[model samples]
Target: MIYVVKNGDTLEGISRQTGIPVWKIVYDNQLSDRNVLVPGQALLLLGQGETGEVSGGRAAGGYAYPFIEPEILGQAFPPLRELLVFSYGFTFEGNLIPPPQDDLWMVETAWNNGAEPFMVLTPFSGGAFNNQLVKVLVGHEEIQENLIRQMLAAVQDRGYAGVDIDFEYVLPQDRAGYAGFVGKVRRAMNEHGYRVSVAVAPKVSDSQRGLLVEGIDYAALGENADTVFLMTYEWGYTYGPPMAVAPLDKVRQVVEYAVARIPPEKLVLGIPNYGYDWALPYERGITRARTVGNVEAVEIAAQYGAVIEYAPIAQSPWYTYRQNGMEHVVWFEDVRSIEAKWGLVKEFRLSGAWYWNLMRPFRANWLLLS
Candidate 1:
């Protein structure tokens, strides 16, 4: 589990509470020094082992491994199927590069755990859409076909059970183009008996408009994909004013509209295993936010001798502390909040929940689900 850095929390203290070694904690989290942590930053505790050993809550030889680290492998192994969705990126040459070793491990871990695994093809470059991928799909039609074929073959050959398309920030005019590309990927993968999933923006209504939400054709995506993973996080983000990651009010609106045209069983609500701590007196493009995990929040509370307080409305936890005369606010996930989200999954009869990342280890979450 992630241990957020607090004013008084020490590595030795956290290690004692978790029964993990202090050195392990330092190495697992990539700490350069023994006593330095950002209040809102998250650290992966488990080792970065092969898939099943890390994120896939898989049990091998009758032992289920603990996902103690967000990006590393903690325990030996376990036997449980974890539903995983990977966001794939392309190479500078516009070719569908294989995922890194860590990804393969994650995939293997998921499969070993009895969980179905899918990859969400996306474009990435310094946090923006990769210009190379966009050029091939938008500018080079011939290369697109080859890339699609290669992707289908690779997924099947690599033993993946499904694929999830995660194309974001597409030009509005390319809505039809995006739809057509998805159809092609689906058809190709289906012939090989692979399931197809797509990630979409959470739209409050069919008429929702904007670069972020407008291009997504929910109806078409619902029809083409076996399941649509609704991106319900980031409503409260670093760049924006503080808010709930998946606010109850906003999520209900998105879900109500989506269910109007999409089947519940084919929908999977997205839940964030992380949170953001924005600087107070937020200024436009001036105050950057820090991302954090649940366990860390507790440590932060402990560090400042700050008591953890819960928000009834958001169903989340927060803590207040002072550092160098600067007041701070921290909001993050906890077992309680995660359980609340799971309630929504059941209430909506969603196929399942998808995590934005399986990079951080949250023991509470595993315990709740397992």
Candidate 2:
């Protein structure tokens, strides 16, 4: 069972509530400061030895840029079966534009760490993802075939186990066109003994709308590809209001809706490995939140003497502190919060979970999933 830290809650208080001892709570979460219990921390009522032995294997993957920090990359590779190298873009003329950063090192690193590296194919032109570029490629039969031909060849040359098609920001009119493109890619790749996966924006229903989400037809994509990765995080975003990155209530709604349309086994729930810090008073058009790793968030709480607080409804940890004559609010994930996510995987009997990108160092998450 998971226990949420309430106001005025102590280790002994939690012990009495759950009938577990104070030492057990301390050991499970690896609490460095036992005396300082903050509101909203989720406590897993199990010991270190007990967790891994029982919860060892669950299918998991993570996205990573070609240039990952050496220290952060070392701890992440062991936990993923597939590390999606982000990404390989395509041109309007049907030529593959590979990642700017060399990915040979990442491919080799995945192999050394017992993971099967996969290539991420995206629709990009010049620099960023272009909906017009996607519409042009998918609209023409010859261009689609040409792109797939090059993609398969690249996969063969790189020794990638498969590909994850992550075409983003597609227009609403291009929904069926994009779905057809995915189906063609899957058929061609499957013939070469390569699997294809697709990432879809999270939605609670077919009627849900926002931020280029209309282009996603969840049911169609689920049938087209080998698996579907639900982009479940980022309800709180860079330009959005302060909130949980992946609020539990919101994530559950997406998963519930997805399973009704797609097979539960084919869904990989996406979790955020990092969080954002927003300077208060937030401005609608101008405010931008700087990204921070989960471990770093806690350290900042300690450094500034800010008490970390949790939102029960969101199942997320956050805190407020003043620095340089400015107030800031941070919402981030911890062991308790992630364990709640893990429970959803079991509750739904879904395939597994994956992180957005493994750039940050979150040792507790590494320990939990490892």
Candidate 3:
């Protein structure tokens, strides 16, 4: 069971209310400082039927970006504690851009919540993947070594459990260099008692051609990093056609290909926690989809009297509505859709599922995870 911490609530108080032992709560959450309780903080009070034991063959994880608000973090802390890793970092320009001072609270809070905190290192610039950064890093041996050294230093300084390499839009010619970089980083980090994970684009075949697919050599990366987060979502993007963010068929194909090359135990299926609402009559360049929270999508359906519909093939929930005399369609995850995706974890024998984000309040999703 999950309990949200209210004002003036203490661990002892919560134990009294939930009939769970104080020591058990502290141990399960790995709470080092019991006196520091924030409002809206979520506490997992294991009940009679709940084992709080993860399946040996599977694990669960999520990505918590640097910009998440404290209140959202409080609410998400409970379920995230059960996850294997809570990635709390983002992509920077081969440098570690410290999160805003205010966000440091989340770092401590995450540790208290029992999730192994990971830092994400990426080659993104101004909201898009920068190809030039990848080129510079891969082409210059000295620069690559220096950057990896700095990264390991940052991880050590920040007390992070590991680092996630999220370099995207890498040049196809640098495939060998990319794998080489990961191998070097992994070897160094292993010596330093840190874990290394890599994020790769969803690919159905080794021969898949694309800027995203070409740079990532699955077998080499799998051999290097401890875990590989397969980004299986985003088929329906902000500027694309209206459809499921992570259509089941597409996700399955990626998993099938991944398990063939990467060990199933080291694969983490990416699950999108949010969805998109696109206006009808979408034009390739003119139309843009507005991102909506999973719960907000339902409220939208109710507000507009739109009838929610389920796409059987996609295993996702969607609805159409009219606002300002314009037709709009929304495709988002519900309990049913999320549960269906969880089934894939077992079907593919994957390590677990990793949520794209935890900024939104999806009580149903949390309950399903519980």
Candidate 4:
């Protein structure tokens, strides 16, 4: 669970309210001064739970919707054992809708293929960070109750075996609220015989505070949600400096901290089937958010006549090409990088690994995991 410090809220008050040990919070963030917490800071609240080995071997999974266009769904279903539906959420104005038509086909195809369909829910589209939405969906009592009811109804009507809530950019203050939301959702889904899961940021400790890390209360999620999916990708991304998609050390830091709070069996590591190419001489104010999947990125490199180079630290492939005399760096995942990440999943004994939006056709990724 996360505790965002308000202007007047104190660590003592938060600790008292949540029943979390104060030392753990301080130690998790590695703070030199315990008394200093910004207004939007996030703190993780660890709870007692099962800890140890996950004996299961690596398993394959995919994210999709059942209602994709006939051609798309037909092309997508033959790949794997698990199909994760995109979402079911109220719009910004607050009206509940079913998954998109394209997604409906994807979900149906997974079922027909004898694959389990997992439904993922989010408050925002395109993975933007939204704190106010998190507060309303999780902090506000009325909204939380309504969301839980709607979630249960959707799972039953759609015949989903499991539900994955992927709420991102939550405010620091809504830490407990998010935890409460997970608890309520879990209760509603479990009573109805539905599996409940949550998507969390990759963090090693509970006290970590950053816009991305603050929103996810890893410990609370570990205790409340049936499965905690750690997004272990994007170490190298479009908006940030050029780097590998999922570096080995960064992933390990997240897993090491996560296991201390969550059971290894419930952890689902995220694998990136994608990569980013950043234009050099980067401008601060300008936006550079073009991210490409592995297949597309590889083709882009070939098109530019860019020779691919490998980074041992990142364990991913990259190449620098000049376009109209401007320097650009492209970072992408390949067989070697995917294998390194998969090795981490095996070492951690995680429940499984999930890909982010299987919109791209990366044949090699499936082959490597299979």
Candidate 5:
């Protein structure tokens, strides 16, 4: 359960309202100051006959770019079982492109902090997902084998525990070929005792069609990998109109559609560790929103004297402020959003969470799972 802090809400006030002791609340969420509460901030709740740990144990994974600040990365890994190193892209000819920053330290650090590291393989080139490059690899059987071998070799050289296939923007026509490649990777990795996972675009049904959704055959991919990460966030994005990044209703629809085809336990819920701040009067194709950390978003609200409000439908927190005589809006995750999302994970009995690039300081997020 989650308790949203309100305007003028106190820990004592919350305790009285929810019938839980204030100390337990503080301990569970690791709140250093119970006297201070941000409006719309979500808090975990525990009542009689409930345990915080999910039954049958949960597997938590997260992704992080090699360039994440050392301080932030230090705080991000203790609760995670796996750390997916941001990426190793490939060219049309199947040559591997390593992460820009030296990743040896990153991989070693994750292992030291108790999370096994996995190499992330993608077809991202230049700046965005390269469909043409992905097409080249998926269309040819020889190139697929070469790419897979290079990936496995790199993972082995780095002592990585596994590899995560993260091909995106695959054309709809190449769906079967993509799935076949994933299967081949999974089998080869399994033989070496390294598990394979895949990050896929969320789909509400098999027939859902779009640049992002059309190429994803969720059921087929589910059968091809050891674990599947449903990228359930990003309904609200950088250039698009402002909205919750991961609306609960939207995530649920994706989960519902997913569990019918994929084994629930094999699915990991993909969540965001960051949020977006959009300068409004949004003009499509022109306006770009700046990504903000969840903690930073709250600080922005406070700095601007903005009062955060809860959008109950989305089960997310948002606020608006004026800057340079222009109104701005922010949609970000808070304690409530985490509880709501993890609640779904528990309800559906999914594997656990996989947070996208942990570059921000969202302390309460890790505290909840801890």
Candidate 6:
């Protein structure tokens, strides 16, 4: 079970209330300051009936087949078990559509490399999430059923291990409908011996408001799906201000919330294999960040004679450099950051960690996973 810390709650208080030891709480959550407790912070409480013991070893997984190159896949596929192709989309009428025809070869390659290939389904059009498409599909019961039927057929025909539902920009009004859709899919897939997983936004509370977190009902979805991948990266994004993609503190909050509602074994934390380089003097909508590989970000720093600094709180590496009289900031993951994320998996005893992509070359990350 997970307990949300209240404003005046202490570790000892939570321990007593849940009949769990304070040390267990401190250790499970990796709390450095036991005295300081933030409201909305999730605390894992052991001995709960539904919440079983954390498994000894977690699976290693990643999203591949889109940005990933053939050469990179040859090297990176060995350490991964679950490989979600990115991805197939849906039309407004709930008709299934395939990704680029070229992706089929990558899917075959992943299967040949001993990775479990999962077809990713999304509500995207023209390379962006289409909110209207989700509303239509979830709102109509007949359409939902048709979509799931097609998905099961597709998964079975392609010899896929499962289907990963990556529906984004879902409207809050369709919350119950979305959960219902997942339940329907889970039943259909389980009957056919296929897996059902969902990719959800990083949310710290059920009441957390926003288009990203609103439609996802974590408790309900956890009960229906085989696994749920928390898209924990992108706190610092292409158009947003420069910061760590998945800050340790923010990631911790999300994990805490998720484990409280969903079982730890069914949770997969998301890790980013890429980073961002932003020009300074960021304007809300004007300044844009360029996406860069983790390794490339470091080379950029060295090229500009910039000093790389690590943010202890975020557990991410960043550096500032000047070019053409303009200051720029680059924040990215390194071996140190990857290790910290993997440590979270061990501490929380989660199902495992999955990279947002296998597109870029991050040798250190692969070595760590191996």
Best by TM-score: 5
Q: How close is every model to the real structure, measured as TM-score?
A: 0.76, 0.88, 0.82, 0.78, 0.89, 0.83
lDDT of 6 by residue, 87-117 (tens): 9888877789988755667668778888888
Please give, for residues 38-126, the per-residue lDDT of candidate 4 as tens digits.
44333445444311112134555756554444553444334466677876666544446566564545556678886778778877655
Evaluated at residue 310, the lDDT of candidate 5 is: 88
lDDT by residue (1-370, candidate 1, tens digit) is 4454555677788776767688766644435557665554444444233121222222111111223242333321232243444456775455786544345665676666566666667777665665346545856567677778778877876677877778877766677667777777888888888878788888887676777776788888788777787887788888877666766667767777888889998887777767777667677788777888655655665577566666777777676778667777777776556666666777777766666655565544554454
Worst ten in a row by lDDT for model 2: 47-56
Most accurate candidate by lDDT:
5
Task: State the weakest 10-residue window (summed lDDT) of model 6.
Answer: 47-56
Q: Give RMSD (Å) of candidate 5 vs. truth.
A: 3.5
| Clash number by candidate, in order | 32, 0, 0, 20, 1, 0
lDDT of each residue in 1-370, candidate 2, tens digit only: 5566767888888788767788877755557688876555556675435443112477778899998986678776466678889999887889998899999888888888898889999876677778888889878999999999999999999888889999888888889999999999999999999999999988888987875688999999999999999999999999999999999999999999999999998999998988999999999999999889886787677577787787889988999999999999999998878877888888898888878889887655655675
Assess the local accuracy of residue 348 in candidate 2 as a C-alpha lDDT between 0 and 100: 91
Which residue pairs overlap in candidate 2's backbone? none
Candidate 5's residue-wise lDDT over 1-370, tens digit each? 6676778888898889889899887766556566667676677787655544532357777898888888877776567788899889987778888999999998899889888999998888777888888778888988888888988899889989999999888899989888988999999899999999999998897888788878888889999999999999999998899999999999999999999989998999998988899997899999999999887787777677788898889989999999889899999998778778888998999989889868887766765676
The local lDDT score (0 to 100) that residue 218 gets in candidate 6 is 94
Tell me the alpha-carbon RMSD of every candidate. Answer: 7.7, 3.9, 8.9, 18.3, 3.5, 12.5
| CA deviation > 4 Å runs, candidate 4 | 1-57, 65-79, 91-95, 100-102, 125-129, 287-289
In TM-score terms, candidate 1 sits at 0.76
Worst 10 residues of 3 by lDDT: 82-91
Task: Using TM-score, rank the candidates from best to worst.
Answer: 5, 2, 6, 3, 4, 1
By lDDT, is 2 or 3 better? Answer: 2
